[model samples]
Each structure stands twice: as structure tokens, then as C-alpha cells.
Target chain A: MIIANTLADGFVVFLTEAHSWTNDITKGAVAETDEQAESLLTAAKQAEQTNVVIDPYLIPINIEDGLRKPTEYREYIRATGPTVPIPS
Target chain B: MYRYDEFDARLVTERVEQFRRQAQRRLSGELTEDQFKPLRLMNGLYLQLHAYMMRINIPYGALSSKQMRQLAHIARTYDKGYGHFTTRQNIQYNWIQLKNVPDALADLAAVEMHGIQSSGNCIRNTTSDQYAGVARDELEDPRVYCEIIRQWSTLHPEFSFLPRKFKIAVTGSPNDRAAVKLHDIGLRMHQNEQGKTGFEVIVGGGQGRTPFVGKTIRDWLAPEHLLSYLEAILRVYNLDGRRDNKYKARIKILVHQIGTDEFRRLVDTEWQQIKDGALNLPQSEIDRINAYFTPPAYAQIDDETESLNEQRTQNPAFDAWVQANLAEHKVSGYSIVNISLKSPKLPPGDVTAVQMDALADLADEYSFSELRVNHRQNLVLADVPQKDLLSLWTKLIELDLATPNIGLISDIIACPGLDYCALANARSIPLAQEIHQRFQDIDKVHDIGELTINISGCMNACGHHHVGHIGILGVDKRGKEFYQFTLGGSSDQNASLGDRTGKGFPADEAVNAVEKILNTYIMVRNDGERFLETYRRVGMKPFKEALYGSA
Candidate 1:
């Protein structure tokens, strides 16, 4: 599991294969199988390896194109949609 | 004490006009908050939690009575009739309006002061001992070199946009009152075996998430090469210090990651390139700056022992203050008087406009129209006569500025915290106030003896809680305030970061926990042992057990 910390807005998100989680227990998604969740965890770890922690307040966010942007305003990012769109 | 040359004067005047236009543009909706944020910060105006804050520079912590009175005027007219002096020896007005800041800068400039280089990523204020020139043990005045650095660093075109903020502290005496070891560049004046004055340069000392005591980079750097050497270090930092990650951007991390030897080699290589450039100090220029700080024409008088003794016998309150707050001056019959800003009811370093004017009058009457803003957030009249001590004490008493808490627990150093700081997670002033009230007993504080209790509202460590004898850090736990205590930090010759004791305490119980820690120290301390000494001898085991109960 990887946690993303945000500053301008408060709260950290825990990311797992099936879904993103906030506040530890609040789940965001459900994968069809546990194997898919494991692959997601591996991808998150790989993303974390390349990410740079600029301000401690920012959290690493993963885009569908396999790039990560550290940002505090996740809502703005969500509104704009990902730079790399996911496969429909 | 650096007199502004025409170039310096013109630069500040132009800066003031620029900021005036920026403010006007922001008000007229020509500039958005995103556009104006960096511009305002470049000019030392910050939008904090409650109001706009303007930081005014006191270069090398030195101030004249005229400059101080101008500060008083600003406090009276523009702010909430008060100002807070910071650990960097700069004064901050917390309630300033955006419209009023340009005028505030202009007011500051009239007294040969400004807020330039006070914020932003450029080199900030160069601080030094408040007793720089007047201290008995000083090799030479550190302010001369500080002024030299200030002139060179102010808006140096190439080095303005560094990775992180840089701080430099200089001290002339071996006592290290300026806390040089905790600065990005710590310059200490020393006389080598040959009896020549030079600086012992230390680099990479800083506090934050990662606190490291600076390592000595040069054993003896000649006074003439001060600017060249500093420029080399700054240039190296600007190019190599991490810009990718702000957390790893301070020169401290650079020094740590590259290792001191490599960092030193880089600086040496860079210095060789710029050694004899325009930055090299000319002998005539050094002498000119030194002349402004020449010793006053002091009259030879006896130590005024009889009068001092008489006053001590008659007035115990004045006697206690004298013992705690006064320092021996280099001149006979003269002493340095600390006008305490740590009254119980007031914020730790807050001084009202009326009090500032009174202090200005006192400085003129007592100390050759000069004053100093100390890093510990107190004001100093550096040349008060021993005979005039009683009169000054009486006046200070009337003004409610005569708290005899210098170097004591009540003389706590605290940041504005969540009460006023935008970055703060919890409040620090209320905790400081609570601790001050808890240890209000003068005799008890005297018995506790020479403790520095520093509190920071956040991990930025502006209050330097990491180096406090008893450091209190405020953290937010589920939206409620929690306090973490650390023990045995000292910034003097034996510089050491404090050790965390254990689990954090809630806000209401922190004062009692501190009381327990002090009580334990009092019980375990040997004779003549200070608080840091006892904490060092027994370690935090005894303190933790005392505060949290034996387990």
C-alpha cells in the first residue's frame, strides 16, 4: 500500500490494487481478482520509486500513462482529467 | 551600522516604487493572487493566517535609536500598535494591510532600513551577537564583515533564485551567542596563534526535518577573502543544491549528500575562479566600514560599585534584574542593559508602539542613541552607564518591560505559531504563555537557572525548538493540539540538538509535564550544574521517567 499526502487540502490516500483508500478504511475501488490488486500495488511501488518528494505536503498521484505528478490539489487534477487518459 | 551608499539607496528606492505599483495592480485586478504571490514575497510581504505580515531587516541585528523609533511609528500608525521581534533579529508587524505595506517599506527606508532580502529564496538577514562591538571578549566587531556580506548578497543577480533560503550568522566572541552553528554559514572571528584575526567558517548547519550542526569548512579565512569565499559557497549551492525537491534543497542536505570534503573541494575550486574578482574586499573599504563602529569616547570612571551596592541593598527587584539581565561592558562604569520583551501578559517578543518610543528615548539617554535587536527577541541598550542603571530600571518597570527573565525559563523563544502563521499546524504563543505563567516565580526561575525553552508551531523550526534546552514542538493529532518535548539542546560552544523524551502530551498537560522535567532536574542536578549539564549527565531516561512515570 502507498499513501499520498496532500498539503493545501488535508488528508492522505492509501492506494491498493483494487481501489484507492483514504483514512485507512474508506475504500475507493474493487478489482475483479486479488491478482489484479497485486499488479496495481507493484505499479504503485514503481511509481513511488521515480517520484520526488518536493514539499512534504504533496502526494504522489499516478496517471494512466505511467507518470506521476506530486500535487496537493487533487480535486483540480481530477477536474482537468489525467494527462494520460486510461483505456476505455 | 552600514551606511547606505548611493547605489544601495537607489536600489531600495526603486524597489519601494516597484512594490507600490505591484500593490496597486493587485488592487486594481490587474494581477491575480498567483501572479502577485511571488512578487509580494520577493518584497518581504507575506499573507499569513490573520493578516498581512511585513518583515523589516535589522542587518546583523544592529539598530540605531532613530531606526527603532521609525519602527515604533509604523507599529503605531500601520499595525495593531505593536510589533514582534523574531529570532533572526528582524521585526515583524503581523496585522499590516496590503495597501499599507508600500508605505511601511518607505517609512523603513527613511531610516536607512528596508525589508529586502528579508524573505524569498535569496540570502536573508545576516545576524550576529547583539553585543558585537561592546562585548569584552570579542576579537573584533562581526558587524563589519556582516555589512560587507549584506552589501554583496543584496540582489546579487546570479544567486537570487537559489534552491532554498540561506541564512548566515557571525559572532565575534567565542561564546557563540549568535547561534552560528545552526546557520547555513556560521562565521566566527578568531585570532590564530600568530595573533591575526580571521574567521573560522562553518557551513551546512541548519534545522528543519533534518537538523545538523555545521561542519568547519575553513580553519582560518582571511578577512579580505570573506566575500569571495562566501560567493563561491553560494554559487556552488545555487548550481548544485537540489531544485527538484524543495525538502532536499537546502545547502545542508547538499553538504550532507555530497559529504563535507566534496563540498569543501567544490567551494575551493569555485573560490579559485572568483578569488580576485570585484567581490574581493579592498582594505580602504574595510577600514571605512570599521570606522563607523569605532569605540565611543568613553569617560574613565570607577565601576560605580558603591552606588550599585546601595541600590542592590535597597531594591531587591532591581537587584535581581540587574543580576540576570545586565552584561559587563568593555568600558568601565558602562554596562549593557537588556530591555526584556517577555512580560507574562504580552506575547514573547511583542512590543507596543509607546514602549518602542520609550525604548528609543532610553537608548538616546543611556546608550549613545544606539540599540540592538537580539536573536533571542530582546532589545539591548549596549552602552548604558552603571550609575544610570537605577533610573533606567525604574522607567522600564513603569513601562512593564522589566521582566528579570533573561536566560531563564520564562525568557522563552516562541514563534507566532498558528495564531498568526499560515504554515503553523498548532498554536505556540498560548503554550509559551502557559509555561511563562507556570514558572512566574522569580526565585524559582533563578534556581532553575539559565534554561532556554523554545517553542515552534511547526517543523519549519523558526523558533529553533530543536536547539532549546527544553524544546516544545506543537503537533496536530486529529485536529487537536499535542506537544512534544525534547531535552538538552544547546546552541553555544557545545552545540547539540535536543533529544526527544517520549510520547507527546496534550496541550493542557504540557505545562505540568515541563514542571516535572524541571523538578527532576532540580532534584538530580549536582551543585553548580546547569539544566543542560544535568540532562546530559543522566540522559533522557530520568526525564522521561519523571514526566511519564517509571515504566
Candidate 2:
């Protein structure tokens, strides 16, 4: 999975299958193999150069119960929101 | 309340315009993220987990009523209607959009405040005791020297890019409520043999990865030589401090590598060149800064002891608040009222825009239209009249700001952990909320008596966990959230780092471990001993036994 923060607002964004950024992690494109992940990251870097996103990186994912999930807790947090409630 | 002169106002205004242009360039794709990151950070703008976070400095923890109201307006207009007050006496907005930041900076500049020097590799905002001018025990107001240091360090061309960020703290009282021993350089004011006031210079103290209790470099330094002495120390550090590794770049690491005596010798050698140079503070300049902090006009009135006792006998709730929150003021009819933002219902330092506005109004009515932010993440009305104690308490209760847990178990210092900060390994605020929930009973908390529990999301120790009586540091163990506990720390005049207990606990079990430790303290405490005193007397053996079942 390729993830980055949008440049304008610095909000979390994920690369979709159409090579565009989406705010929802569930709708993000997933790569099955290392080569696919590398290619996806390379495409994301082009978007970065075009001033769409910043610090694009690959986050490993696991398919659990027919849903994709982030492997690291940090990525999981970034994908979802904060584990605690924030002021409304 | 140091009003900005023309130079100060011009500097801040120009900086805001510069930031506006930089932000525009970034938005218009003229500058890349790499180029904009440093520029934004120099203005105290950071991209955290969720959104852009902005940290605004509150010089010497002091804020006038107008400034406080302006902050409230900023929170309501530009942010998510709230702000988080940090342990450095600064306020952070966790959800600021990058596009709105320039306008926010302009708003702050209108009130003589900005985020400059609040971050970056420069001398950050110099913190002083929250009870600076009002404390009965202080020799003189430290904010005078704080403002002087602020003027000297802001945009200082020579020391702007040091090994890393530098922090200085000053305290005028011998009791050391400002946590001076945990700063990069600590200035403790006292009288010499001739009864002339000066500062005791302590160098290279900090609280991050490698914590060190500051060592005294000079027994007594005359007030006139303060800026020159500081320049000499900064010059030495900039010349020899390590820059290869970011972790080892702090002055504390340099002071530790080379012995304190050697560091002092180097500073002295540098001081010989610049001691009487342009950096030396003239008496007239000192007097001019001192005049800004002259005591407010106090009316001639008797102490309200008899009336206070009558009210105390009638109202136990007010009495409890009076006992826990009020500090002795130098003036007979006055009291220092601490407003606790550490209610179990909210995060430790989080304050809503509504609360800020109401508190500012209360300050205008009760105090002298002035409020202060403490390093403990609480607010202070420095000059409340004793006669108005009941009325003030009544208003605070209505506003949900009357938590009587100052210096008690429920008063926890917590950093914005993984929930907001990108550097965090585990969530700190939720754990703080958990501990607070267990200890929110006022009677039970008062019985614990003067215990400090500081929580940091990671080893960065921004929450001052190293000096907590019971410190909890959140760690990621095998992809799970775990917490490590430290015991027997104090950040007062006799400051020391906490010693780690045997092993770490899971998030849920950490709270139980804290309970066990406190239960042991309650079981073994002497008649008048505090939690720290009992732990110091008995050592960590009893606590280790209770937590790990006598293994």
C-alpha cells in the first residue's frame, strides 16, 4: 500500500488504483508482490513531484477476514484516526 | 505582561508577512515539501499524525487578559475550537489547516505574540516560574531577566543555528517550582553575602533520551553579566558540541562527555573575551525592563483571615478548593489561584475556546486581568483577592474548572502522544485519562498528598516523566502498547531522575501497577511524609514486591 500526506493540508491520503489520492484507506490500491509495491511507490513519487502528496512510502498490509489491514500499529493509526477521542 | 516596543512589533509583523509569502509559495507549487518543511518548522508549524499542528509561545508563561482572549478567538476561528497547553508553557492547535496558518500568525502578531523561536535550533522561549512576581518566597521577579533573555536570544545571528534546540528556565525562588534543574541552562536568583541579588548559573540539564540534573557552574554571577555569561556558554557549546548524531546533539550530552568542571572552564575562558563586551546588560536597560514588571497598585486592606474562616466553616467544598488550589501571596489580602485543566473528563492540558474565554473574563474580574500557564499544564490567576475566594470558586465550579487536584495524584502531566504527535510509539493521553479516572476522588487524592505522575508517549520525555514521583513511559513491545514505570523522582529544589522498576506492563496492567505502588505508599507512609518522602525512605524494594508479587 502506498500512503502519503497531501501537500496542501497535510492530511493522510492513500494512492488509489487510478493513481490518484483518496482520503479513505479502505478504497486504497493494494499491491500483492514486491515488484507491484515498488511500481506503485514509483507512481506515487511522480505524484509527489507534481505537488500532490509528500513523504510517500509503502506500508505493508495483511488481508484479515476479507479486509485489508495495516501491519504496524502506527500505520493502522494513520489509516484510521486516533485511538482516543478528540474534541468535537 | 511585557508590552512590545516598536522593534518587537516590527519584527513580529515582518516575520508574519514572510511566512505568508512562504506558505503561498508552497501552496502554489513554487517550493517542494523538502524546501517548505524547515521554513514552516522555523515558524513552529508541524505536520503531525492527523493535521498541521501550530505551537505558539507564551513568554515566561505569562498572558494578559487581552492576549488570552485573542487566543480564544484564534481557537474558535482558525482551529477546532480548542487548544492544548503544553509543558513548556506554550499552546498547540492540533487541527490547524496549513492554509489558515498565515492568517493565524497575523492574528497572533496583532497581540504581540508569534510562534517564532518557539521551535527550531535556536534558543526557544525561556520559561520562568508561573508564580514569578507574586510568590512570597521569591527574591525578585525572574520574568525581568526572562524578558531580557527573550530580547537577546530572539533572532540572534550568532547562535541561531546551534547543535540542537536550546531551552533555558529561570526561577527566582529558592524552592524551585519552575523545574530549573531540568533545563539546558537554569538561572536561580538569590542574594550574595552583601545582600545583593544575582543568579546561580547551572548548565547542561535536560529531560530527553539522556536526562541529567543540571550542575552549578558558578556560585554567584552578577546581574549585569547575565547576557554575556549566557553568550559565552552558548559560544562554547556551538563550537564544540556534537553535531554528527541528532540524539547526541543536545548540550546535556556535551556536558556529560566532557566533565562539568571542564565545561565550566571552557565557558570561563570564553567569558574572558566577551564578559564586558556588547552583550553586557547595562544598569539602565535592566531598570527599564524591571519597570515593566513593577507590582500592580494594591489597595490598603486588612487580611481576610476572619472572613475566610467563617466562609470555610460554612462551605466544605470551597474550603477544600481553598486548601488545595490557593497559594500564599506576598500581599496580605491576595491569593494565587491555580485553575486545573486536568479534569478526568478531558485530556490533561486541553482547553476549549469557550473555557478560555470564560477563564479570561474570570481573570479580569478576580485577578488583575492577568493569567499564567504553568509547566504542570494548569492555569493561574496570580493576584486573586482573598475576599473574593468564594465568589471565584463558585464561578469556577460553574465553568467545570474547579478541580481541586493541584499537586495531588490526579494531577498528571501528559504529552500529546501517538494520538497527535508523529514521534510517539504509544498513546499517552488515553493512559493519562485512565489513571485520572481511577484517582479522581478528591478526598482520596488529597489523602495521597503531593504526588506527581508524569506520562510520556515515548522516551522523548516531553511530559517530564523523568522527574515524576511515578512516571509512566509508553513503549511499543512486539507491536503491542506497553508502559514502563519509574519510581522516586522529584523536580523541585532537590531534583532527581526517576529510577526504573523491574519490567514493563501492558496498558491495562500499568494502571494496576500504579495502584499497587500507591497502596504500598499509603501502607508504609509515616505520619507526615509525602509519597516521594516515603519512597525515598523505604526505597523501591517494597514497590517492586507489591507489583511483581514478592518475586
Candidate 3:
């Protein structure tokens, strides 16, 4: 799965729904194969041109119970956001 | 306290205008990321893990209450209502909008501040002793020289691009609070045989993947020739420093490759040309900048040490705070109050907008209208009167900042880690929070005594883990978070690097590993001995044995 932060305000973004960036990963497509992941990255690279998200890249992940999750702890933190509140 | 002149004002305004245009261009796709990266970096706007992190340079870590209020305003208006004070004496807003940066910088400029040259491959904001003028042990106020260097290095046409970013730190006292020895260029003020103040010029000291304590390039450089000498060193570095690899681009690599003696010869050769040339700082300009940093109008008040002692005896919390946080001021009646940003739960160095406003108010009411940002990511109310210590402590308590864990084990130094930084390999903040939580009792923490536990998300050393007595560097093993510990590091006058523990602990065992080391210290330490002192005396054998459990 390709995960990134939006350039405008820095929220979590996932490549979802035909290569569009969205916050919801459940609605997103996961790479079924390495070839598909490569193709997804090629499609996602265009998001930088739109200047919406910066440095989009693939991460190790596991999909279970129809929900996607990052395989790594750092990726999990980035995907879910900081454990602490934003302090309003 | 050095107010911007008309030229400075004009320069800041023009830079803001230019960055505004560049921001617009980037948004509209007129500029690509490759073209726009340097421009944005020069303005201190960075794309971090979650958002755009805008680093605001607080020159010499000096800020007036008005400037602090402006920072609070910017945090409230443009960012996530708080800012993280960095280890380099700057505050970073982690959640900034790319479009809002120009406006935020415009607000900063209204307070005579700009982010120029803060993040680019240029000389960054010249950091110095937080208690520059007021330290009892100071030979000179390093801020005067800091301002001099700031003016000399700011927007220098020749140094706009270099091999990599350069950092300089200066100190005026024998007690090295500024960690001057761990910078690209470090200047330590001292008196020569004739009782004239100059600097012991040290170069090539840095902490990163390759860590080295700066070597003394010049034993004594005359005060008048400061700028010329610095320009000479930089000129040599600019021409000769490596550029082939980004990892090896720092001037430290150059100094290491050529050796300090050869590097000194080159700097000296360059210096002879500019020694009496236009770069020689004029006496009037030096005096003009120095005048801004003279001792504030101190009242004829007694030290009141007896009463402060009495108050400490009465209130245990205040006493713990007084013991840990307060430093003796040059003026007898005043005390340097170090406000700890390392609360037990929150991330170290994070301060909220409301807290900033409150600190500004505290500065105005208790201390003078000035508060200093220490390079340890704490704030200093430098001139608080001895009599007002209790009241200040009370106020801090109300603000949830009176943790009284200043030099204690709980007062951790951790970077933003994977939570915020794009470059981090593993999580640092969560590890730090775990450590802080593990060691919570103030009495127990105080008994542990004066252990600097620094954690960096990666080997970049943003958390200054290289100099920590107990340094923790987070690492990744097959996408799993692990931590590596180091021992016997000190950033004081006796600057030294830490030695790695030879093993890595998975995230679950990281805090337990630290606990084992600390337990070993408690077991083997002499009376009133700090962790570093014990580690230095005994060497690492016992601690290694404790962690790894024998051969």
C-alpha cells in the first residue's frame, strides 16, 4: 500500500479509488501483487504534480477482516496519527 | 535583544515577499519540487511526516515577551496551537499549511524575526549560552559575538549554497552550557595573558552518523579579528569541503579528512588575506551590538539566600524545583529559573500557545520582559529575583510545568521521531514517554540524579543522544522498531561521544533495558555521584554486564 501525507495540511492519505488520494484506506485498493504495487506507484506519482501530497511511497501492510493495516510500527503511527491529542 | 535596523527590516520584508511569490508558484505548479525544495528550505518550511513543519529561528535563543506573544499568535493562527522547541534553540510548528507559511512568516517579521538562513545549506542561527550575559562564570557575553556572526553570515551571497548545512555554537563561560564543542564551528570565550577577551576557535565538532568532538583550531583569536577569522575558516571550508556524497558533505568530514592541523593552516592562510581587510569588524559596530546586551537595571536587593533556604525547607516541591532548576545568577538578588518543558506525559519540548502566552506574562511580571530558549529545549526566565522564586514556582505549578525533574531521569530528550519527522526510522517519542512514565516518582528521580537520557528517532542525532550520559537511538530491524543504547557521553567542557551498547532491544524490551542500566548505576554509585561521573570512573564493564548478563 502507498501511504503519504497531504502537502496542504499534512493529514494521512492513502491511494484509493482508482489512484485518487483519500484519508480512508478501507475504500482504498491494496496491491495484490508486486507488479500491481509498481503500477499503483506510477499512478500515484501524478499526485505530486497536483501538488496535493508529497513523497508518496509503498509500505509493507496486511489486510485482514476487510481492513488494511501497516505492517511496521512506524507506518502504523504515521497512518493512525499521533497518540496525543492536538491540544485544540 | 538586538533590534533589527532599517536594512534588516527591508531585507526581511523583501525575503517574505519573494517567498510568498514562490509559495504561490509552487501551489500553481509553476515550480516543481526539485526547483522549489531549496527555496522552501531556505525559508525553514519543511515537509514532515504529517504536515509542513515551519522552523522559526530565535536568534541566540533570545526572545522578548512581545516576540513570544507573536509566536503564540502564529501557533494559534497558522499551526496546531503549539510549538516544539528544538535542541538547536529554535521552535518548530509541526502542523503548518504550506500556503499559510508566508502569512505566518509575515507575522514573525512583524516582531523583527524571519526564518532566513535557518534551514538551508548556510550558517544557521548562531546559538549561544542561554544565560549569556547573566551567567556568573562568563568571561564575555557571547551574544555580542553571536550578533556579529549573525550579521556577517546572514544572506551572504557566497555561502548561499554549500556542501551541507552548517551549524555554529558559541559559549562565554568555562561551564559549557551551549554544547559548543559539538558544532561545525564552536567559539569559546576566554581571557588571554594580557587580560583581553578572545575565543578559543574550535572547528569540525558534530554529532551524526559520524560523531566527533570539535578540535581547537586556534588557542586564542583576538576579539577584534573575530569576523575576519570566521570568514577565513568558512571560505576555506566552502572551497575545499567535499560534495560528492550528501552523507560526507559536512565540514566535519572535510576537517577529519584533511586533519585539524592542515585545516588550521588553510584557515590561517585565508585569514592572512582578510585579516586587516573589509571583513575586520569595526569597533563602533561591535560596541553598538554589545550595548544592547548590557546588564539590566538590577535593584539593590539582597541575595536572600537564608529566606530562600527557609522557603525550600517549608515546601518540598519548591525545594526540589529550586535544587534542580535554579542556577545562581551573576547578580546576587537574581536567579536563573529554567522552566522544564519535559513534563512526565507530554512529548519533551512541546509547549502550547496558551503556555507560551502564560510564559510571556510570567516573563513580564516576574523576570524582565525577556525569556531565553535554552538549547536543551527548555525556557529560561533569566532574571527572576531570589525573593520571587516561590511565587514563580507556584505559577509554574498552576501551568502544569512545575515537574521539578530538571536533570532527573524523567527529563528525557527525544526527537519528534516517526510521529512527525519524515527521516525517522523508528519511534522516539513513544520510547521517551515510556521511560518518563517508568521513572515517575520525583523523590526516586531526584535520587537517581542528573542523568541525561537523550533519544533520537534515528542516527541523525536530533535528540542530541550522542552527548547524553545514557543515549538511546531508535533503529529498525526488518520493519520492527528497536532501540540501541550508548553510555559515558558528556557534552560539557569535557566533551565526549557515547559508546554503543553492542546490541539492540526490540520496542517491548527498550525501557526495561534502560531500567536495568539505571538499576546498575544505583547499585554501584557513590554518594551524590551523577550517572556520568560514575560511568566515567567505573568505565562501561559493569553496565554492560548488567545489560548483557556476563560473557
Candidate 4:
């Protein structure tokens, strides 16, 4: 999966199947093969060039129990909010 | 407490407008992320793991009541309802939006504060002792020198783009509460044989992947020579410090590579050329800056010991707070009250907008309308009258600001880890929260006695974990989270990096490891020995035995 922070607000977003960015990781476009990953990253880069997002890159993910989950904990944190409760 | 003059005001206002334009351009697709990153960083805006984080400078850890109120407003208006007070004596808003940052900078500028120099490779916010003028043992107020450096280093074209970010800290007292030995440059004020005060200039001390206790370069430098000597040192680092590898780019690395003696020789050679130049401060200029920090008018009064004892006898919790949070003031009737932001209910150093406002009000009412942010991630009400202890304690309790965990086991200094930082390897906040929750019994915490547990999500050492009595660094073992523990670190007058225990503990077992270490300390400690002192006495033998089973 390709992910980025939106250029306007710097909020974490995932590249969607529609070549657009969504804040929800579940809605993010996934790739199974290296070629698919490269194409997805290329599309994310296009989004970056168009100023829809900033610093786009690929992140590993798995379809666990029919839910999209990031492979790395850091990436998982990026997809969700902070693991700990923030002060209100 | 230095008020902004016309030039300072104008500089900040102009910078805010410039940043406003830059942020607008970035949003409008007129600038790429590559182009906008540096500009945003210069304004102290960072794109972190979750959202944009903005760092705001608190010059020498000092804030007026008005400034504090403005910060509260900024927190309520531009960000999530809270702000994190950092170890550098700065405040960071974790949930800031890039679009909101320009306005936030404008808001900060209204009160003579800015995010400039809070990030970037320039001289970052110059930190100083929280009890600068009020400490009983201080030779001179360090904030005067801090203000001078702040003015000189702001947008300093010569040293803006150095090998890496540089930090400078000053301590007015010999006690070294500012952690002088762990900064890029540390200035320790002391009297010479002639009773004249000057600074002992220490250079190349920092903590990260590499930690070094600063070595003194000049034993006694006259006050006038401070700026010139600093310029000379910075020039040496700028010209010769490594720029190839980011890891090996700090002045500490350079000083280690080419010995400190050689680095001092180069600095002295450069100093000879510029020592008598315009950078040399005049006594009049020093006095001019010093006037801004003049002691507030204090009334002649007794120390209120009888009344304080009466109150202490009545409320045990307030007594615990008084015992833990109060530091002696130079003045007879005044006490330096530390308001611990490390309540287990919230993340360490995190303060809500409501809390900020209430604390500002408390500062105004009890402390001459002034507050100081300490490097230990606590707020100091520097001038609370001794007689007002009970009243202040009651208010703090009402506000949930009376945590009485200063210098105790639960008083953890932690950085925003994988939760917010882009460079983090594992989560620090949750670990800190867990450890803090495990030790919430104030009686047990006080029994632990002056132990510091610092957590950093990565090796950047933003949490000062290298100098923690028990340092916990979060690391990733493959894809799982693990923590590396280091023991016996101190960032005091005698600063030393902690020794690492063998291997890393899995996240679930990390707290159990801490419990066992504490148990071992309790078993072997002598009377009146601090955790660090006990550790130093026993060496790592006992700890290693307890932790890794004698090998």
C-alpha cells in the first residue's frame, strides 16, 4: 500500500484505488506483486507532484481477517492515531 | 522576562508573514515538499508520523503570565487542547495542521515568542536553569547571557547551516540543574580566584547514538568574551565538522575524531582573530540585558515555617507535595514551587489548554506573574510566597496539577515516540504511561528517592535517556517492539551516560524488568544513598546479575 500526508494539512492519508488520497487505511489501494507496488508508488508520486499529498511512499500491509493492517508497528500507528490516549 | 524591543518585534512579525506566504504557497501547489520542507522546518514545523508538529521557543525557559495565556489560547485555537513541554524547555503541539501553523506563529509573535530556531541546524533555543535568578547558590542570572545568545543566534547567517543542529545550555549555579554537560556547548558560571565571575566554557557534549560529557575548553573566560568565543567555536565546527554522514556530523563527533585539545586549539586560533572584534560584549551591554532580569520587589517577611508546618501536619498529601515539589529560594519568604506535569493520568509533560490557563493564573497570583519550564518537563512557579503554600496546593489539587512526583520513579521524561515522531522505532508514550501507572503510589515513589526514568523512542536521545538513572530506549526487534535499558546515568554536575543491560526486553516484560531492578536496588542500598549513588557503589555487577542472571 502507498501512503502519504496530505499537502494541505499534513494529515496521514492512503492512496485510494481511484488515484485519490483517503485518510482511512482500509480504503487504501493494495498491491500484491512488485510490479503492482511500483505502479501504485508511481501513482502516489503523481499525486505528490500534483500537490495532493507530500512525501508519498509504499508501506507493507496484510489482509488480516478481512481487515487491512500495516505490517510495521510504526506504519500501523500512522494508519491509526497514537497507540496511547492523548490529553484532552 | 526580557521584553521585545522594536527590532525583536519587527523581526518576528516579518518572519511570520514570510512563513504565512510559504505555507500558503505549499498548500496551493506552488511549492513541492522538497522545497517546502526546509522552509517549514526553519519555522519549527515538522511533518511527523500522525500530523504536523510545531515547536515553540520558551527563551531560557522563561515565560510571562501574558505569554503563558497566549500559549493557552494557541493550544485551544490552533491545535488539540494540549501541548507537550519538551526537555529543551520548549513546547510542542503534536496535532497541529500545516494550515494552522502560520496563524499559530502569528499568535506566538504577538507575545514576543516565535518558533524560529526551535528547529533547523541553527543554534536551537538556548536553555538555562529553571531557577536561574532564584537559586540560592547561583553566581549570576544565566538568562541574561541566554537572551544575548538568543539575539545573536536568531537568523545568524554565518552559522544557520551547520553540520547538524547545535544546542547550548547555561547554568548559573554549580549544581548544574540545566544538564550543562550534555549540550553542544555548556556555560557554567563561577568565580575566579579574584572573586570575579566568568564562565567555564565546555564544548562537544551531546547525547544521541553517541553521548559524551562535555569537556571544559576554557576554564575561566570573562563575560565580555562569551559571544566572541562562541563565534570562534562555531566557525571551527562550521568549517571543519563532518557534513558527509549525518550520524557523524555533531560537534561531539568532530571533537572525538580530532581530540578536544586540537578542537580547542583551532577555536583559540579563530578566537585570536575575532576576540577583540564587535562580537566582544561590553559591560554596559551586559548590564543593559541584566536589567531586564532584575529581581521582582519582594516584601520583608519571615519564612512562615510555623504556618507551613501547621498546614503540613493537617494534610498529608499536601505535605507530600511540599516535600517533593518545593525548592529553596534565595529570598527569605519565597519558595520555588515546581508543578509536575507528569501526572499518571496524562502523558508526561503534556498540559492541557485549561491547565495552562489555570497555571498562568496561579503564576500571576502567587509568583509575580512568571513561570519557568524546566528541562525535566515540569513547570516552575519561581516566586511563590512561603505562606501561600496551602492555598497554592489546594488550587493545584483542584486543577489536577499537584502530582508531587518530582525526581521520583514515576517522574519520567519521555519523548513523543512512534506515536508522533517520524524517526521513532517504537512507542514511548504508552511505555511511559505503563511505567508511570505501575508506580502511582506516592509513598512508594518517595521511598524510591530521586530516581529518574527517561524514555526515548529512538536513539536521538530527545528524552535525555542517556543520562537517566534508568534509561529505557524503545527499539524494534524485527517487527516487534522491544526496549533497551541502561542504568546509572546522571545529567547533573557530574554527568555520565548510562551503561546498557544485556539485550532488549519485549514490551510486555519491560516493566517487570524495571520492577526487578528496583527490587535489587532496595536490597543492596545503604542509608541516604540515592539510586545512582547505590548503583555507582555496587557497579553493574549486581544489576547484571539480577537482570541477566549473572551472565
Model 1 residue A49 CA deviation (Å) reads 38
lDDT of 1 by residue, B1-551 (tens): 56788998899999999999987887666675667778988888876643567888889878888988999899888887888899999999876878778888998888888988788898999999999999998889998888888888899898889999999999999998999999999999998889999999999999987999999999999888999999899999999999999889999999999999999999999999999888888889999989878887787887999989999999999999999999989889999898888888788888888888988899889889888989899989999889999999999999998999899899999998877676876778888888898887877989999999999988999888999999999887875778999998989878999999988899899999999999999999999899999988999888888987787
Evaluated on chain B only, what is the TM-score of candidate 4?
0.99
Q: Top DockQ: which candidate number?
A: 4
lDDT-better candidate, 1 vs 3:
3
lDDT of 4 by residue, B1-551 (tens): 79999999999999999999998898888887889999999989888988889999999899999999999999999888899999999999988888888888998999999999888888999999999999999999999999999999999999999999999999989999999999999999999999999999999899999899999999999999999999999999999999999999999998998998999999999999998899989999999999999999998998999999999998999899999999999999899999999887888899999999999999989999999999999999999999898999999998899988888888899998888899999888889889988987767788889999999999998888999999999998998999999999999998999999889999999999999899899999999789999999999888888988963
Q: What order do candidates take by DockQ, descending?
A: 4, 2, 3, 1
What is the clash tally of candidate 4? 0
What ranges in model 2 sit over 4 Å off? Answer: A62-68
How far residue B50's Cα lies from its native spot in candidate 4, in Å, is 0.8
- The residue pairs found clashing in candidate 2 are none
Task: List clashing residue pairs in candidate 3.
Answer: none
RMSD in Å for model 3? 1.6
- lDDT at residue B241 of model 4 (Cα atoms): 90
Give lDDT per model, in order: 0.83, 0.92, 0.89, 0.92
TM-score of each: 0.86, 0.98, 0.97, 0.98
What's the true lDDT of residue B138 in model 2? 88
Which lDDT tens digits does candidate 3 get at residues B65-89? 9999999999999987999999989
Q: How many residue pairs clash in each candidate at the backbone level?
A: 0, 0, 0, 0
